[model samples]
Target: MDIRVKFLGGAKSVTGSKYLITVNDFHVLIDCGLFQGLKQLRLRNWDDLPVNPEKIDCIVLTHAHIDHSGYIPLLYKNGFGGKVHCTEPTLELADILLTDSAKLQEEEAEFANRKGYSKHNPAKPLYTVRDAIEALNILEAHPFDLTFRIHNQIEVRFFHAGHILGAASIELIIYSSQGIKRMVFSGDLGPMHNPLHFAPVKPPNADVLFMESTYGARRHKDVDLEKELRQLILESDKKGGCILIPAFSVGRTQLVLYYIWKIFQNMKSRPVYIDSPMAISVTHLYKSFSNYHRLESDSEFGHHIFDAPFVHYVTEQSKSKVLNTIKDRAIIISASGMATGGRVLHHLFHRLPREQDIVLFTGFLPEGTRGRDIANGEKLVKIFGEEVMINAKIHVLDGFSAHADQDELVEWSGHISEPPKMTFLIHGEKEQAEVLRERLIGRGWNVTIPDYLETFTLFDHV
Candidate 1:
């Protein structure tokens, strides 16, 4: 049989991207993204395996985003023993994100059980923090684009896809007695003109391809991110209110932090508070990677930025709760970027009010999320079963979104050597993925949008 492919994750709904590539006796998984959205998406993470995890020989991570990497710990929990390979930056970020995800999941379950809000008496976490740490123990770091053998028959390499700090597009070279074939997996692609990092690097050529459809169908508004964020910050403060930023801690938060540093350059006013407990932990990781250059601006600018006395980090639970009491208006950054869950929910429930506060969004807000409501101009946001008036200002820095737009995706593909036999679109909503698929189809590219668990065979090219 030809090489086989399975759509384990990231398909019509955009979350959970797991694909199996098997040639001869060698097998490898391209990505093990966690399905994140509503209960169904989260439950997918707990579902039994369609294929035995032990049978898989290796895993290639596209980047360190939670959806792409969150399930790794669960894989470990299930006794998958293969090495997890990624770029050095991805490895570092994955360590931070996966562990944090486990903690959050466990904490959420515990809270649910305590509050009697869960259907299950236990309401256990999908995977524990220890599981995440175990998954981390198996990671093998490699440099980008350097072909390495995961097995006797499979050779793989990674290229920077530029969606965020350590994001990449993956390429695989499958060697067989008949010939050598290639497949490419486009992770979340960063913008062509993104301010945070370099543009995404495209594939060198492949017989089969998998591209992301996160922003495939739409174009972003052309505006200066710094100016836009500054306006939001200024107006939010005009009424002496706090600014609540529900940001993806990995890419979006760092980008906002950079722009906030930029905002502080011309104007000075109230202080800013980083209230996500996980975000505080992630800040150290960001510093270690230099992903947020402005935070490093002290060194880049030849002075200490956080050294300033006003930028406060709310690490402890007590400290986070106290933000509600701080009479002064401040900028508070929280996690669970979509406001689906996380400390941001607490902030929204307690702090959001008429024009006295604001919710500044940086990433795509999934449906049925508080962030989505705010972005869609919902006047009232229901949090923890209570509707809170969105009196504070609302804004979306779409440009700061980590994923690359359509034009950028096409530009990144230029580096590929030969067209793949197929290019699958994953990790995007139906509309977004379709937008990207149509664009590629117009160019005569053989692309397919796989559904959850759909399988395919990778036939060898003549």
Candidate 2:
């Protein structure tokens, strides 16, 4: 029994989320995600594939989040013809996200070529949108909570992660001559009371577990996020200020709009503009699978918060410029949540330096992102290759975070069915990971924080 688990990404830093496992000659790559953040992390995507894609037997995804699924187009482009397994909702979301990501890369490359900013003479995209579409055609859908065999010796199953619409925590069982080897990969854990989704299921018993520690170190603020959303919109409208919120296109955007709908339920009038074209379409995709959401059928919430009026879809440069004339009295929710890319950059260029306007951050901003800099109170910043002074009244409501808090993680894992032999923490900063490790150890679990690219043998009886 030779089982080697390699932490390719998402170990120490929170960006790229790749992990590879090998049992004899059978190769399985858990994720082949893009490394996002500063240039150092982003450069990893440009390098050659870590392993020969042809030799990999299968690729299983935990969820559709870009850090976990971004590089699928690149994988397919690099000659990985294997089956990619995920839930049905995850497949739909990935279909939207991967195509959009490839298009964005092409757009970026074109922009770079025009502006002469890129080192490449004619700036080529990492992978084209066609590559993403090709990858999408090969997707294999598997339902949650069902155990299915992949090979003679390996079985794979997924449990609902409750993090987003179709998130999951993966469990793998490999039969060896000595005994059975069980491993669990806990994807991004959702909060206890997520606005639209149900709480995640209990962790299953296993010999090894890979858990995320994104929110390990801190506790979120106790505030009714709905109330806060109402107040923010009212105050900004009264002051004739355009409120800008940079949000992720998928789960975070949907949650924010749900709160927006909550506020509008009481308001008499308002003009809200959802600028990102990707978000508008993704919102529709979200509705197509609305049955997967807990709140879609809830009596207390409207079924179509995404279809609210005053929400204009902005895609082209000309249409986006129309927002400039929008009299500083409307709400604008744009994308590239971390202020990293997308149309949000143009919005921030104007809004950030305006004292009357407001910029609201809703998602987790990693260390090197522009969103983190603004949230942390950096005075002057760069946008679209120009330095701009910070004048917008930046408001960061800590309650808007999407991940589960420290107590939630502990409480959820503490009451699992079977205790794990060893736990490895990933997708967290050092401070957060270390604190969570100590706290988990206090509860009497064998926890190991694996270093980046660390390798560990699963069975001792090899």
Candidate 3:
């Protein structure tokens, strides 16, 4: 059998992570993520895949991040009818994220049509809620470390990736007529020092490896997170202004809450409002799956970290809208971390023009995202099809990122006892991927950075 690998997405970009592995007539897809960030990349979501979705046999998910698992609904709508395999927590998280994703798209499309700002005459959502529900019905949950068979010649196992609650790096054992080979996919490895997660598990021996390079070009700065958060909060409070945090609902939001809780314990605490409904739901999962993370204990205040008196969960649209009227002494946390879409946009539309308010971002912002533009000090940002002045104090706290940095990535790669025949770096921008490729080469490992839709032969007549 001839084996080949193709990069359908996540080639030289951080978003839309999909990879296709083919062994003769059998086909398996790893990750069916949506393309985000730049307009050109987002347009790819409307384009047809080179291969028919129905032709793909199965899908294996690495995590539940939108960029990693958001495209399943669209694929299901387009004719993909295969089982989606992932860890039990991943399955649960994906259901929430995918449903939210569909709702956002539908809402955006309807708004665009009403406003007549979209180029398309009548904007339409890529997929609907029904599609997402249908796609989710096919998901098959599995536990980490248990070997399972997807095909007669292929066996699969999962290792702790430490990125999120159930994120995992996958190992595939393929048995062919000629011999046996192992292929490993390093799915979004988390930082070694993340408070909520343990360190990523080292990779077992492999003949082929695909690793993530999200932060390959730089290292995370060592800073006192508590001190920085305290200063920001104090400064905002002194100005009699609210601090708006655009954090990812999955990991970053929870981490930010933990740090804020610590800071509140030592000082006067302001009301912290979590404005995203999805984030509120995701936070509750930490309680359900105690073994998945390290936040099982209560805080020094004798309450669950998320159950503090000053912390408020906003669920209703009416309550969320009321928060827009507040102008001082509050910390509002919202979703769509990049400010691509979500309730955060409404908050941004109202607060960006206020010089006293602070808009704080807690993670990586990809190219062409509104969060990146604001963080880059753009004076004006368009919101709701209208130009809005950006007078708010903009800040980015990189220490809160969940992805592993250059040193951590190198350390993770070094855990492999022997170098693979070839290592392809995926899930990073061009410059970052190239930097990682050079670094690995210095360590006596062969590395290649694949471009979008590129294909490479892994074995011949195996």
Best by lDDT: 3
Question: Against the unseen true structure, what C-alpha lDDT does each candidate score?
Answer: 0.76, 0.83, 0.92
The number of clashing residue pairs in model 3 is 0
State in Å the error of residue 2, model 3: 1.0
TM values, all candidates: 0.93, 0.96, 0.98
Ranking by TM-score: 3, 2, 1
lDDT of 3 by residue, 74-107 (tens): 9989999899999999999998999999999999
> C-alpha displacement of 205 in model 2, angstroms?
0.7
Taking all chains together, the TM-score of candidate 3 against the true structure is 0.98
Q: Give lDDT for model 2.
A: 0.83
Q: lDDT by residue for model 2 over 186-244, one digit each (tens)?
A: 88888888877778788877788888999888888788888887888778877778899
The better-scoring model by TM-score among 1 and 3 is 3
Q: Which regions of candidate 2 fall more than 4 Å away from where they truly are?
A: none
lDDT of 1 by residue, 1-462 (tens): 367887887878767878777775567887787877766877877789798888888898888888788788888778788999998888988888888888888988888887777788988998888888878999988887688988777788888787766677887887777777777888888777765577776467777778788877877778788887788877766667778888887767656676777678788846778777666666666567664232344464322444345678877888787787754468888898988777778877776674577777887877656678778988887666467887766777777777777777776765665666788888888888787787788877887888888988778342
**Pairs clashing within candidate 2:** none
| Candidate 2 minimal-lDDT segment of 10 residues | 295-304
Stronger candidate by TM-score (1 vs 2): 2
Candidate 3 overall lDDT versus native: 0.92
Tell me, what's the RMSD of every candidate? 2.4, 1.7, 1.1
Assess candidate 2 and give its TM-score to the true structure: 0.96
Best by TM-score: 3
